[model samples]
Target chain A: MSTDSNPITTEAEEKKEEVYEAEHVHKVYDIIAPHFSATRYKPWPIVERFLREMPAGSVGLDVGCGNGKYLGVNPSLFMIGTDRSRGLASIANHEFKHEAHVADALDLPHPPGRFDFAISIAVIHHFSSPERRVQAVRSILATLRTDKENPGRALIYVWALEQKNSRRGWDENSPQDVFVPWVLQKGNKSKQPKEKSQKQAKNLVETEVKATASPSGDSAQTRAACEPEEEKKEAEPNPVYNRYYHLYKQGELGADAVEAGGKVIEAGYEKDNHWAIIIPA
Target chain B: MKLLTANFITCSVKSCQSVTPALSFRDAELAREEIDFSPLFLRNILPRIDWPLLQRTAKELGFPALPETKPELSPIAEGDEEGVGSEEEQKLLKELHSLLLETSVQSGKLVCANCGHEYPISQGIANFLLPNHLV
Candidate 1:
């Protein structure tokens, strides 16, 4: 009964924590890919402009090209897309009809100078560490075509820690780590009795949310098992899945891009995001 | 995975570009009809195609021979204009178009010449997940 007899050590506990952190991000993306894609159908104007202005027939790369949204902006430019998510990559190739691969942004499959131009939109910020973020940018830079006459360029987008809207901005004093909210929707089941229609169902959902937040005790599976069979058969309530985000302050991304051996051409904020354009140095 | 375009992929290992004839393609799927072939579009794309490397790749892929050297860009006024070039040049363009756009690696492995990394291509999408040592 001695607590000191526990087999787990600090190193093992820390490793487990690290694994959980990584799982949190990857699992969230896997679960939300479809919902995320549906709302992201429109290509951001700046990204559209960047792709459109790329020289005709230049080879382009779209890193983290979820659903291959901007892959075919310029048909003349042969483009390749990649994403860490296998589901997204499959959607890119089969559904969107774009050439895409399932690859990590930090370690791209293509060799140096493979692309005339490259872009990583809203991707680098997902890295757990600052060093990894820089590595991700540099890795993409290496694949860019670096001829002097037509030096290749890269465009990157990261979430901004500070925004014009106060509600969206984070405190400058704290680390730029935060969790943004993602709401998961489960369709309402029609099998519920007619008397328990809308109002009663909403009340039940609210009560269920409180019950799931149990501070006192049982494991999640235990709690689920304890629920009544009839309740288990009912439509599940919507759950908020908080997503981890590493926000960058103004000039932060540009500085990292430069430190990673890129020459920053432009850096600024748009909406709740900070974006930059750089050329490999 | 059309073997003809394998030249574009290189070793994923650090500090190794690897020599040609290093990476080999297998089970290439040629489906160029899926691409919209516009002469104007292809004309602009012609310059970026590494002719020597592409020829070598095509040979490896078991496709018919490409011209010994890269063809000069057709001097027709507008790529879309009729009588854009002579019959010989037009024939070359059509061949180049098929070689570049139509060929894809649907199911295969892209083995790195130097580090021996095997990047698998399944359902026309390459899974380039490298182990921690390589990363």
Candidate 2:
């Protein structure tokens, strides 16, 4: 809610704005749960590698674990995944059979030093302010099980304001605070024969494909291959869910973790995502 | 919905860790167990386990046999190396594994000791979302 025109002023006011923004972000996810989960099937290789390397039966926590994609990386590890969206949590529990709970990222349910390892993927960027993003990271830090022998580590990923394959402009003056759109399927049926509607729907789907073409040829190929035989038949106005995001600049995430009393072990970029490995201080 | 792990849950109302501290499970239902019992896994997990909290949780759940102090990890187990263990160690491992992995609270409410905020576990998933006023 802290727009460019009316900038946030007082600390208390900023905090209040952040709470409203957080609620809005959660609402967006709650609305787009199905659409979001459909496209988020693959696990990022970096996250999979981290989970795979963990000791067997070691307890791990996944904050904002959307669809629980990385929760079942290793069967031996006891992973507890949490997300704000109940729909996504139910999908994770019922479809994937993963252990997940409906919980907030900032105010987590667990105590201090509760988990041996933790992760928050594509989560922090959703916060409207840098301070709330840092607070979210601190929440993860509070749950880490750091001790002498076992120094708990966490991996966090945020969408970078600077992206290589950004179709959307990544100008220096580009607002880090912006709304990204998620186009949903048109639900209402038209007054036409079933076969003709299917053909028209196919044409609309093709038009959609052309309009939203990505820079990557791989995506184009995948989309083209998966097009036919699908029921894209509805003829209705596509709903666009505009979700808020505060994309982090390079080094921004690492600095925030450090500010939250965490030591950055490694910091680097993976595609449009900037990630860091940190041990809670 | 299946119970994952109640080992890490705590009362956040005023940072309360007092008497009746940290919500305890009572008359709960155990629903799911995905991981197989391994003596090595249990031994490796010993140090990470919050002994006092788990013991308190177990007592509240109507299983009062967990020792006051954590049992020593047998040297012969070589759990970190993923080595199998002897029969004697397996018996001990079974007991620990049952307490940690097997027993899961499917449905219950977690009442805070100090402020008395009831965190309900429905559909095998606990809702830990506190209201704005509470925060």
Candidate 3:
């Protein structure tokens, strides 16, 4: 991958990555939050079990809790969820009545070493650089409690590169950095793209998809599956917002946790995602 | 955001880490929404609550002043785990539930003591994403 051969080291490169992510990841989620949230009501079984097992009244953080689906899983536990997108955070607060806020993962608003536990599900993969990914993990680990007898833990999950059985067909050999498309079907009054002309939006999506798909052969299939078929009446194409994802290879999630000064208690692949339970070192 | 949630939040800016009572409420609009009362949950969470901070928050939000010291509940006996405690304990737990989980800040600004960065709360959701300079 280009990121491997040309590592992001300079300040300018870091700033560029931030801008890139803002456009590809943050803005895309904001545009698709309602539609995205409609399909995200189900809590993954492992995450539900993890939340249920925590002692009642344990206070925890949910870093990048999109739509706050997991926040209300355990009524006894008090969990404050933060998401980068204001749109998703608002849904979390309004629809779910969960305590959620808009906050970036790297610059969280919580006190360090105070929370009893934290969960970052499918969040860190949005970081465009390896260093930023590790830094994001470090920021999350900082919020956990450090007591020896009952140390706070974090549960993190990221999309796995080795998901051959999945529909996307990404494997270990596929380029880790790629743009995943999110097609916003027309006529969804709430999910319309804001402040962009149709031509401009189409050009932006084409350029991004072309630039990022050179290494991956199945990009077309990915886009085809994302676009819904019910929009045949609309003359213009559905606005496809490409999201950047750094698909993790096997063991990388645990490695990132260790690099961020955490000890991996348990790690495994579950349903095309790599998840780990980690604690402060 | 709940009155209870404010105790856990601090200024997002890195330099404001040492500021005591990390955030203060400004023009907060309060609402009382009834939720299920759970005494066992309150007993379990009491150890983690910052009494002084909670007191300060309660005062700022114009609620009745909290007790100077954190309340202590007797240990749960083997068979009485699910039973609500004696009348006194039940009263305390109900008060706490009304204050912490039921009373929510519907809209306001959370001002940092050190940096003076105001995180606006709208529709009961606080926006803690800082500007580029702070990041």
Least accurate 10 contiguous residues by lDDT in model 1 chain A: A208-217
TM-score of each: 0.79, 0.79, 0.87
Q: Candidate 3 residues A172-206, lDDT tens each? A: 88778777776775454333344444434333332
- The 10-residue segment with the lowest total lDDT in model 3 chain A: A208-217
Q: How does the DockQ of candidate 3 come out? A: 0.72
Q: Which stretches of candidate 2 lie above 4 Å from their native place?
A: A1-19, A148-150, A169-171, A186-234, B1-4, B17-21, B30-35, B76-84
Clashes of 2: 0
lDDT of 2: 0.71
**For model 1, what is the error of residue A136's alpha carbon versus the real structure, in angstroms, after optimal superposition?**
1.2
Ranking by TM-score: 3, 1, 2
Clashes of each: 7, 0, 0
What TM-score does candidate 3 reach? 0.87
Residues A1-281, model 1: lDDT tens digits:
65677768754553443344355455776676665554455688889889999877688789999878898777867788888887777777787778878777866767687688888998877775666778888998998878777788999999877754544435455346655555543453212234434434333322211122111123452132122223455476356554555778888898899889998887777878889988988
Q: Mind giving the per-residue lDDT tens digits that candidate 1 earns over B30-78? A: 4545555566666776776667777767886787887898778757766
- Tell the DockQ for candidate 1: 0.59
Query: If both were scored by DockQ, which would come out higher, candidate 1 or candidate 3?
Result: 3
Candidate 2: tens digits of C-alpha lDDT, residues B32-130: 475576766667677767777777777777775677687775576344465456666677778777777766677877777666788887777778888
